[model samples]
Target chain A: MKLLEDRIKKDGQVLPGDVLKVDNFLNHQVDPDLMFAMGEEFARLFQDEKITKVLTVESSGIAPAILTGLQLHVPVVFARKHKSLTLVNDLYTSTVYSYTKKVSNEISISKRFLDADDRVLIIDDFLANGQAVMGLIDICEQAQAKIEGVGIVIEKTFQRGHELIAEHGIRLESLAKIAALEDGKVVFEKQNN
Target chain B: MKLLEDRIKKDGQVLPGDVLKVDNFLNHQVDPDLMFAMGEEFARLFQDEKITKVLTVESSGIAPAILTGLQLHVPVVFARKHKSLTLVNDLYTSTVYSYTKKVSNEISISKRFLDADDRVLIIDDFLANGQAVMGLIDICEQAQAKIEGVGIVIEKTFQRGHELIAEHGIRLESLAKIAALEDGKVVFEKQNN
Candidate 1:
């Protein structure tokens, strides 16, 4: 977590309207070593939950989720933003509104991949307003799957995402929690440990 | 490679119109152990290239590309299919037509991540018609980066993708070379080695 926090401090760009650009090591461009380390940390945090599957949205979340899957020895399922030809039917779909993109995307996962007997761990790159995480949680509920916990690479603690997941009674862990972005700088939350 | 081929034969579904649905392992729901093995194989194949970066498109390609980056100890950059708010300018963009999706996507990579001094290895989940791979190659050319080779998880040898890369004079290595889909079965090309 310290590694991520440090890297964020060094490279994370704070833009207007609460935009933190981490494309250098996350989002667009990725650091596989950092992803692996984060995955190991997530595995360590949720090792006791008996997670059967790691679920995430497409594009950004795939990298970290797959690495977490590698560490936990579980299958990684990514919900597609676009409805491809092969993925037309038998899907659990949810609509998520993105404040940054200013659009609502219909995220879907094939029903065959998730089921009632599975324990799911949701992972994502960032949790801003919690719409995306809530969408994944919606899919999990549709499949009647047990929600184990949520792991986030970077979280904005000033946002409502934290409280939303907490409202669902699901344990949430973030590698780097940004307390606030003040005067073009990132303020991290105090670590409990 | 044998492990991948075996898994493909077991779990890969050959749909209508030469479509091989590998969502069970390689696409939608991913098996991270197999991905790590494929990544290791790719790393071994391009070990001498001194790869500074691994490039691929978003979503499906992220899993293997990140794993490959992990093995090679380099950063992985995934071209975004959809332009987000933060990634609007200073990009190396190319248009790629997806036969499966029947759409042309303008994929772009931030100019900040790639440079002329970088040695890049392009990795992707599937090489069907080679449009996606060609798009990445175009971006690499724009960046003036040295492309060491291309690594594919599954290559339809019967398609034009292999020949297209060959025509570009780029070395390509596919973990599974699919020969044909006959009578709802996946027939892999005979391995030379």
Candidate 2:
């Protein structure tokens, strides 16, 4: 977590609209060694949770989630943002609104992947407004799967995302917690895990 | 390679219109250990290429690409399929046509991530018609980067993808080469590496 927080401080660009551009290392261009370290941290945090599956959204989350899954020896299931020809019906579906993109996408997972017997740890690249996490939680609830916990690479504490997950009584662990972005600089939340 | 071929034969389902659905292990529900093995295999195949970077498209390709990057100790850059608020200009762009989805996607890589000094190894989940690989190659060419080779998790030899890459004079390595899908079954191409 310290490594992540340090890397974020060094390379993260604070853009307008409270957006922290970590595309240099986290999203668009991924540092696999750093991702492996984060995955190890997540695995260490949730090692005793009996997690059967690791859930995440497509694209950005897949790198961290798959790495975590490798460390945990579990299958990683990524919820698809686009409805492809291969992914048809018999899915656990939920709608997620992206405030940045200003669009809502129907995220889905195959019904065959998650079920009542499964315990899933949801992982994602960032947690801001919590819409994406909530959508994943919605799908988990529909599948009757137990929510073990949620692991995030970066989180904005100033946003309502932390509060929303807290309201659900879910155990949330974010590697780097951002308090605010002021004058093109990142402010980290004190006493972060 | 044998492990992946065995996995495909065991869990891969052949659907109508030549769609081999390996979502259980490859795309939707990913087996991380298997992915790590594939990454090791890929690293062995291209060990001497002096690859400074691993490139792929987002979503499905991220899993294998990240694993490969982890093993090679190189940075992995995934081209963004969607134009987000944070990803502005200064990009190398190309269009990829997905025959399965029947759509064309504008994929872009940040100019900062790739350059002429970098030697890139392109990785993808599937190489069907080679459109996605071709798109990545185009972006690499635009950046004046030297392409080491292309690595694919599964290659449908019956399609034009293999031929396309061959015509480009680029080295191509596929974990599992599917010769054909006959009577709802997958047939492997003879004499596969």
The top-ranked prediction according to lDDT is 1
Supply the TM-score of chain A against the true chain A for every candidate structure: 0.96, 0.95
DockQ, all candidates in order:
0.94, 0.92
The models' CA-based lDDT, in order, is 0.93, 0.93
* Clash pairs (backbone) in predicted model 2: none
Q: Model 1, stretches more than 4 Å misplaced?
A: A83-89, B83-89
lDDT tens digits, residue span B66-160, model 1: 99999999999999885334456798899899898788888999999999999999999999999999999999999999999999999999999
TM-score of every candidate: 0.97, 0.96
What is the lDDT, from 0 to 100, of the residue A85 in candidate 1? Answer: 40
Which lDDT tens digits does candidate 2 get at residues A1-193? 7799889889999888888999989999999999999999999999999999999999899999999999999999999995334455798888888899798888999999999999999999999999999999999999999999999999998889889888989999999888889999988889822
lDDT for each residue of candidate 1 in A52-110, tens digit (9 for 90 to 100): 99999998999999999999999999998853344557989988998886888889999
TM-score of chain B for predicted candidate 1: 0.96
**Best TM-score goes to which candidate?**
1
Clashes of each: 0, 0
